[model samples]
Target chain A: MKSKTLVIAVREYLAAVKTKGFLVGLILMPLLMGGGVLVQSFTKGLEDPTPRTIAVLDRTPGETLWAALDTAAVKQNSGTQVLSVPKPRYTLKHIETPTDAAGLDKTRLDLSDRVRRGEVTAVVEIGPNALKPRPTTTPGTEPSEDTAEDSVYFSTNRPALLEVRDFVSRTIQTPVLAARLGQSRETIEAVSKSSRDVLASRGLARKTDTGVSFEPRSNEAATLLLPVAMVVVMLMVVLVGASPLTTNIIEEKQLRIAEVLVGSVTPFTLMLGKLLGGVATSLTLGAIYLGGAAVAARQLEVLDMLSVGLVIWFIVFTIVASMMYGALFVVAGAAATNVKEAQALMTPMMLVVVMPMFLIGPLMNEPHGTIGLAGTFFPLTAPLVTMMRLTTPPPISWWQPVAALLSSGLMTVALVWLAGRVFRAGFLLVGRPAKFRELIGWILKG
Target chain B: MDDAIAIEGVRKVFGDFVAVENLSLRVPAGKLCGFIGPNGSGKTTTLRLIMRIYAPDAGTVRVLGDSRHGPADDRVGYLPEERMLYKSMRVGEVLTYLSRLKGYKPNRIEIDQWLERLALPGVARRRVQTLSKGQTQKIQLIAVLIAKPKLVLLDEPFSGLDPVNSNVMRDAILELKNNGTTVLFSTHDMASAEELCDRIVMIYKGNKVMDGTINEIRAGHNTDTLRVRLANLASNFDNLPGVACAIAEGDHHELQLTPTADAQAILRELQQRGPVELFEIARPSLHDLFVRTVHEGAA
Candidate 1:
């Protein structure tokens, strides 16, 4: 009996695992993820070198202001501007020679006309008189009585408008504050120099707080892992999707082969081989996917999602899911006489699986929340939680996942026992579902 | 030696109807037994019970000694009436596969030998779906015999066979009997049953009506008959003096010689009427007796 079951299992595995589809899934999955990463990095690198050229329209002077703003960070972003229109280096091209308010009105009309026609990006009017300083109103902080006033006019251009705002708040105010405090420009220059070194560290810390980061490297990695894990969990979910009991009943009735096979082999062995075969197929595909991702990450410098912890949990949870579903499906399939009944009976199982798909966002959100903990520990939801936690890193005590794995494993064993009982009777039943009372009696009678 | 098949008081009830009730019979080893009955007369139900296709409600069936082993035992040879052969499989492959399922890997060379013995019309590579009805019948015969079990059970093996294929099957069943293989087959064709069966069990409405050798059954019924032909007529010859009872409307008289009188005396006295062209005396065959016995039993 043992040998027969092993032979059947091996045949099933070989039939599915050696197919070109399996091989393609193994090889293509990683290559695709890795390619995505490489492409993103390539685009990021390209954008890095496409220097940002900012237009200067300060009325004071170019050399002095340029020097003040030419610290390490701003210099890194400056580039040559195209020579389409002849304009001042740091002042407005159409400033009026106004001795009165009428002259200012003419100047305003001329600038407005050019702006509406989209001639220039934006106009910055800066001559100390136009600077308007708003005091910081943070609670418990006294407002500075002596403040520098400057006005910078903004245009309708989106980036240009934003740039003009940034120049006033970031560059002009800092310089003005230091001057009012009787500090030299050299002291302010040192403080700006130190801030650039800490930018990348801040970016890294921000992402660590959120495992599913949108930073080029981690987001692309998370994106790849999300689908891979989703596919794994989905395939495992098929165990629940199509119950073994349902098929067992239908097939036994169809060929009467059940009458023959059951003579020698016990029911447990039969259910075990079938469920294990499905799990084995899933594991094989999972391994292939992970291998592909690993190889691509190495060769193409892409993000790898099949971390040691992820692979372990994925295997553990998928096996549990396969066993549990195999047990449940066998009962369902065995209960059904026809395919239509089987499908109808399976709708609830579908709802059970799809409910988790909706909960996947939460699993992604809180890998160790009430939902995540429920998903991880609950036999029905754990298979997906195991993978979702990889994409959306969950926060909880480390033992939470361990406890989930152990608990679901125990539940799956119970399911295996239940499935075996269903298989023994249901596998050969060709007629209608055993009445609920009968089914329950069968469960207890044994 | 124990009978190859022995069912003692086997009773099967489906809801209210008894499919086979108190059925007790035996087919000794090496004898060809035909299970005969009308449709729904429990011949198939009895055969299925013997094959363990269905368990008897009350009684025991001993096949090759032990009854516990299922029809899947491979020691039993069975060809169901419905004729299930995998259509996608090649004829030879299916033949070999069925043989293998019965625990024998009948070599293609030997399979071809059997096919040739049955005189199969198509090549070995032909798919089963492509074969004509007669040809498929031959394949089924070979599939059962390829394993060559001690007891072979066939249900309506002659249902669709043409004259030629029918003869071919007849020869094959005879050959199995010659080789000491006990065969059990169910059929409605009384002529074939008379020709092939060494003994038969007749069932009706899930109950045993009669079971014995053809000779024993015929003698038991006693519907003895005689056939004669005459060139000229003895007017009212059907009511003639020497012929106590004559059944002839035209020129011939079919007279039943009385038990106390000799048939030769009647034939000589019939010469005055006309020169008789032909004379014969023999008991009725099993078919004649089956109807006579069943009708008489019913009355």
Candidate 2:
């Protein structure tokens, strides 16, 4: 950089970094994110843990089903105590059922009242032939309500009690299956245990000189979280770093300081200086956040999850995205005569910066899919989408990252050059802000 | 002496509006030149062209003997008509930053000295926004001159300044001239232009209507106008011989002479009419010249 540009950059960087707003933002972002998690955990610990009482009405003409359900609930409740936060316990209360249809309707009405009054958590009604095998229906055909004898109805006022519903549904399946097969409980248990198979996913094993070594079991959740986390962090850095350039430039122009500065240095130099300054500020923010994350990950023994190669890639993308967005923001500032106009011009650019976030899920699902490849090649989205692809399973080929870097780097240069032209033409422009068409004209003509 | 600034056949237009047309001018080194014109008459545009802030559509602008097209070299400084500075920065920091851009490493001492010279002592540490309007103007002037350029261009340097601050600014510009620095400034204040400028350049409607030293410009115009004050308050010179026109000016009357009228005869006629307390033939003031030039050009 030229001495003049460097001087301007130093001033720009200090001007932004020294502000109280910057400090507040720097501290507030992490606090908000961490505080959200802390608040959620604190609220969870305060949940009502009283065992939910479920009323059961069995019309299958047998008392064995209720007894079996009671035993299963006891076993489940015992097993939950070993965990850090015990699961919700369920207590079954058997209700007598009548043979007549009118009596059955009355019993259901009483149960509905009890559920609504919060006297019981839910009501489970077993159909008269719940243990019987379900009739097979042809494809695309449905069984009529009157004929669906194997159905069980579970009703509750609270739709969000999914865990309670799932527990009851799982616990009653064995008892019903044994009754329908007319087999003893032990025999059914043995058969069920014999036929079950558990599937576990693991990373590919590599062959060593002496023997083949197996890789550790894959944590699917962590695998998905890493790339998403990287992309989120990158997006935050770019937004924080580049968004301020527009306001700063607009302020300088509105204050009429731009003309004085341009009198000393060319408009291009002034713009480039500010761009570098913004990039530097963003990198500092990223380092602070990522460094804290690294320390925490190390303490949790998950540091290996963030490989050195991935960290380097994060830095590369952050710089590229910052430059591209920063230059465009500078142009927006130069073309606008006020903050409102600057914001109006910056909306589209902001959308482009954040558009990759919406595509992250698809890009992670298929790293080499059409959308993923398009995002990787399109300069604007490449930094974010490519970071997501890097962390997802079925890692992309080595050349993909290299190609993305090249394409994005080239685009950044082109944008900076274009921004310089617009800045030169618009820096001294005073009065109403330029229209989009006029801005394009400046870019083309300058 | 070499010309500090030289523009040859410069033409600049914005859209369909021609801001400057076929203009050429030169200012000798170490001379103080006043650029005078009506608003929107292209004085600012010409100055920007010399500073390379605006490139001419068709022209060559050479400043400090260098003609390369880019930002003006470090030897030239400019203070725009609009007074502005970074309101958030201290006065000293802004000065240092601007000075560095010109390749001058200004120290705190140098900034303080410039501030002191502009009658702005102890303001180096204060943010520009905190200063009064006059103080801000003085700081802006110091920002331009802190680098000690060979040539300085000021646009409306006295626009918003109080009389005291204007004197301070005027003294600074005179000091620059005495130190062999070329100064070119534009303003509507004709008295200041006449008192301070060694030569004046007047442009009207994008054309140079007059350009010369003060004496030369006055010598070029007709100097047959006479000022007369009489003891009789009802006296008038409308019918006096060889007087083409006459107008009352407070207690005095100004008479315009026909080309062939004699100054001695006009004086004698004024004395014979009444007790002439004062009588003299005088040249037109700079204010009169400016008004006449603009009016005639408009016509």
Candidate 3:
């Protein structure tokens, strides 16, 4: 760097780092994130613990289904609590089946009123043929919807109570199967126990010189959380570093300080200086957050899950992304005469910066899929998408990341060059900001 | 002496607006020249062209003997018409930063010295936003001269200053000229231009209307006016022979003469009308010349 540019960079860096807002933001981001997790954990134990009473109208002739449901509820209620918080208990209330359709409608209305008044948590109508075995369907074909004869109608106003639904569905399976087979429940239990060892999932075995060795259980942190976390951190750092450039530049122009600085150095030099300064500021912030995370991970004995190679890649991507976005932000600042105008100009640029976040889910689902590969090659999304793909299962080829870095680096250079031209043309314009077309003209003409 | 700045046939345009056209000028080294013009008369544009802030569409601008088409080197300093400084920065820091940009690494003591010289002592520690308007203007001047450039361009350096501050600034400018630095400033203060400029260049509508020493410019205009003090306040020179118009000055009347009119004949006519205590032919002032040139261009 030229000495003049270096001087400017030093000033710009200090101007940002010395502010109270920077300090507050640096500390607040992690606090808020950590606070959210803490709130979730604390709120988990606070869920309602009152036992739920489910009204059952068993229309089967044997009347054995209610007895089975009562026994199942007792078993579930006796299960151990988690985190010292009791699980929701269930109590079954048997209701006699109506003799006619009119009688059934009156019974249904009474049950609905009871459910609304919280006297009963839900109503379960077990159809007369519920225990009859379903006809077999062909392989790869979906079964038809259950008819009223074999359907178990579980109705509740609180449809979001998924745990209650899961428990009821799981407890009735053995009894329903036993009735159709004309066997005792013990026999069905015995068959289920025998089939329990029929299936298991394991990682692919590696062939060693001694023998084939099975891999250890997958680490969720290393495989799933690490890459997503890294990409999020990269996004945060890049934004924290580059987004402020627009505000700073607009402030300088509005204050009329840009012309004085422009008088001393070339516009490109001034812009490059500010960009480097912003990068330095962002790196400082990232280092603090990452350092804290590292210490915490070490305390949790999960430090090994943090890959050094991934960290290096994080820095490389952060620099490339910051420069690219920083130049665009600088262009926005130069093309506008005030903060409002700059914000208007920056909306599309900001959208492009954040576009990768929306694609993270698809990229994570298929790390080597089309969307992932496309994001890796597209410079704007490469930093985020490529980072996420690196940590997902079924690792991508090595050449993808290398190519992504190269392409993004080249794009950064081109953007900086374009930003320099717009900056030179727009720095002295104190009137209304130039339109997008005018900025394009400046870039091309320069 | 060598020319400090030389512009040959400069033409600058903004969209369809021609800001400067077919203009040429030269200022010798160590001379203080005043660029005088009305608002929107292209004076600031001309100064910007010299500083290379705006490159001419078709012209050559050589500064400090270098003809390269780029920003002026560190040997030249410019204080723009709009006084601007980093409001959040300490005055001393701003000065040091600007000085460094000119390739001069000024220390705190040197910066303090410049502040002291500008009559802005004890302000080096204050943020620019905290300073008053006049103080900020003085600090801006200090920023321009801190590097001691061979040539300095000041656009409306005294625009917002009070009489005392203006005097301080005028003294500082004179000091620069005395120290062999070329100074070119643009202003509408004709009296100051007449008082301080070693040479004057007047522009109207993107063209040079007049350029010369004060005496030379005055000599170029015909001495076709007479100033007289008569005993009677109501004495009118309107009906006098060879007089075009009469304007009242305090305790006197100035009679404008036609091309065929003689100053002696006008004085004689005034004497016949009343007891004339004083009578003399006077050259037009710079203010008059500026107004006349603008009107002529408009016509």
Candidate 4:
């Protein structure tokens, strides 16, 4: 026969998982996560294969800007060599037109129809003084700057069209400024490259028996995205699992059912059972979210960015984190008289579980810095902060994670002991709800 | 025979308030004992102390020969006053879980038998929240008794129950006693206590005021009061000899006799003055004794 604690744990597990809410969470979690990847890929593939034919009506030195736009497009396409297919190519067409307002209006009307019919993606009209610098003093007047009047007109409301417009403006503006400088094209290019200061970003290099060797810098997006995802999943599981534990205990207390239960089983056994149930709840939700994330990463071809070591750490951290938070939830639940009372009592605990969220960005930026190490040592934030550090380029020392795991495990045991004392006294308490001081007194007395 | 439950000098205090003060009561093995008291009379507190839900300030409680302080023994069963089960769980599941907690492996056949016995045969698969209030109470009762424990402590089992359900519970308690299970129940419902209890223990102001068989306690009061209901009686009913005082009741008169007066002698004199419809020597009831005992203790 199973021990009473295991029986209670199994009962709590089955009771929660069989509910309709669990079923909804089970189905919706994966769909919501998987849909994000599918939508991004779908939009990327939807770009029209036929090169978008853009009509350019230039008044002064339009040929130079058109050449620059093609060059930028080639550079961007070449960077897509990692993918199986090439990016959408742009073809710029020069159209002849008078530089007067009426001529511009007529040309626009002619091109707008082609754009509407999908024959052209956009029309760019360069102003009459496009390549000339504005007069510093407007012919015997106060000095003022002149803004460029270049315009891009497109018919479609698609997002890719917006991207194309941005590319065209950037391509033209670079050369226009170069023309204004009155320098040769080669001199202008050399000056533009050397004038701007760009910071070099590199991963940490550690000393080894073979001398210094640098680890490759992690992908910036993956480094931030993975930890943020893990933090979010942790927060969600804690909230979902812990709140129900509080409500369940309060229900038993208010209804006086706990009095009957404790008569059959010890308060410690009952509390341990509840903590185990909480672990099961959190693990179920963790599996769905983590599994969805893994599938999404594979679909996006970024699975390699997530290592086997990081996955192992994530699993260990989730279990330890769940136990710590789960015990607190049970303690709060046992100490409360009602649902409202339970929520009010759990505020401090909830804050502890979510404090790591605010530190996620800093931890990702400096995975081995003081802030990260501090959070890793704080028992409440250790699991998530350490997991975040593991996802970074630099590997954390083995002792840090091992110590964090042990700390969390010890904390969980202490909380279970604390909750058991509270349950013994508070479960049968009548009249007003006991305050935090009284609960502390119970713990001390126990 | 070993007493099923024995509490000695059990005292419990919460904060500055004394909930149970030097209270001790016992139930002999295989007897249906009623714990009688008004609200806040420490009945529930004393039961909690016995079940080890709360440690007594200065006392010892033994149940089924185990007195060590800890969780309740598996041989004991307790039915708390308020009824509660997991609202989302099926009736059978709740029963199974509770029985398993008491170290019993309750199979489907056993669960169905208890369900049928409680007249809740078709509700084994129904969620507890869906059941009526009376049905829910019955389910809770089954959870308490499913272990077939040696000692059963039920607190206010019949409170809020309708007549039919109350009878069902009353019968079940009697059946449990017949099966050699020692039963201790606390309630303010006097008539149920009078009807079902083989022995009655009454507490007041956190102390044991009266404890004995119902007849023994009643006989101990020895009020020597007689109740006579007359269809046709003389106007001077108060003038009868040996009647110290005459208190008029509805179509009857309660007479307190002198210490040396005989009840039969009063009946003989009353027969000459009026037609005697009914005549009985009054025995004090548990309710009457409880009120007088609490009031006397207060004074």
Task: Say which candidate scores most in TM-score.
Answer: 3
lDDT of 2 by residue, A250-351 (tens): 888777888788788988889988987888777888888889878976775667777898889989999999999898898888899889998888898889
lDDT of 1 by residue, B1-76 (tens): 6699988999998658889989899989989998887788888777767776567889999888877733344567
Candidates' TM-scores? Answer: 0.60, 0.85, 0.86, 0.78
Query: What lDDT is reached at residue B49 by model 4?
Result: 80
Residues A1-446 of candidate 4: C-alpha lDDT, one tens digit per residue? 23887888788877778777667766665566456887898777555556766777766554666667667777756654345655566777777866677987787788888787878888776665667765556576776645445432334434466667877777776677767767676787788788877677775686889999764555456666777777777667655655578878887877777887888988888878877776787778877777777787787666876678777777778777777887788778767777777778789888888899889778767878999989888888888888877777667889999988888778877877887788777776655778879988989996
Q: Which CAPRI tier for candidate 2?
A: medium
* TM-score of chain A, cand. 1: 0.54
Please give, for residues A126-207, the per-residue lDDT of candidate 1 as tens digits: 4443323355568988865532224445444446344435643576656655554456678767776887667452112234
Tens digits of lDDT, candidate 3, A1-446: 28988888888889888877678768777776577898898787565788888999988878667787888898978873776888778888999999998998898899999999989999888889988878888999999888877877888998887777777778777888898888899999999999897877565687999999865445554466666677777788788889889988888877777777777777888899899988888788888888987887777666766678767877788888999999999999989988999888899999999998888788667778899899999988888888888767666788999999998889999999999999889888887899878888999986
Runs of candidate 1 with Cα error greater than 4 angstroms are A1-216, A219-224, A231-304, A307-342, A345-358, A372-446, B69-71, B90-100, B105-117, B120-127, B133-143, B224-284, B289-299
User: Which scores greater on TM-score, model 1 or model 3?
Assistant: 3
- TM-score (chain B) for model 4? 0.93
Question: DockQ, per-model, please?
Answer: 0.08, 0.59, 0.50, 0.60
Query: Whole-model lDDT for model 2 versus the true structure?
Result: 0.85
The true-versus-predicted C-alpha distance at residue B202 of model 2, in Å, is 1.3
After TM-score superposition, the amount by which residue A162's alpha carbon in candidate 3 deviates from its true location, in angstroms, is 5.1
- Candidates ranked, most accurate by lDDT first: 3, 2, 4, 1
Residue-level lDDT of model 3, residues B1-299, one tens digit each, is 89999989999998889999889999999999999988998998898788777888998989999988664488889898885788889998988888888888888888888888878889889999999999998988888898989999999988989999999999999999999999999998999999999999988889888999999999999998788889888766667888888889888888888889877766667777889898888899999999988888889
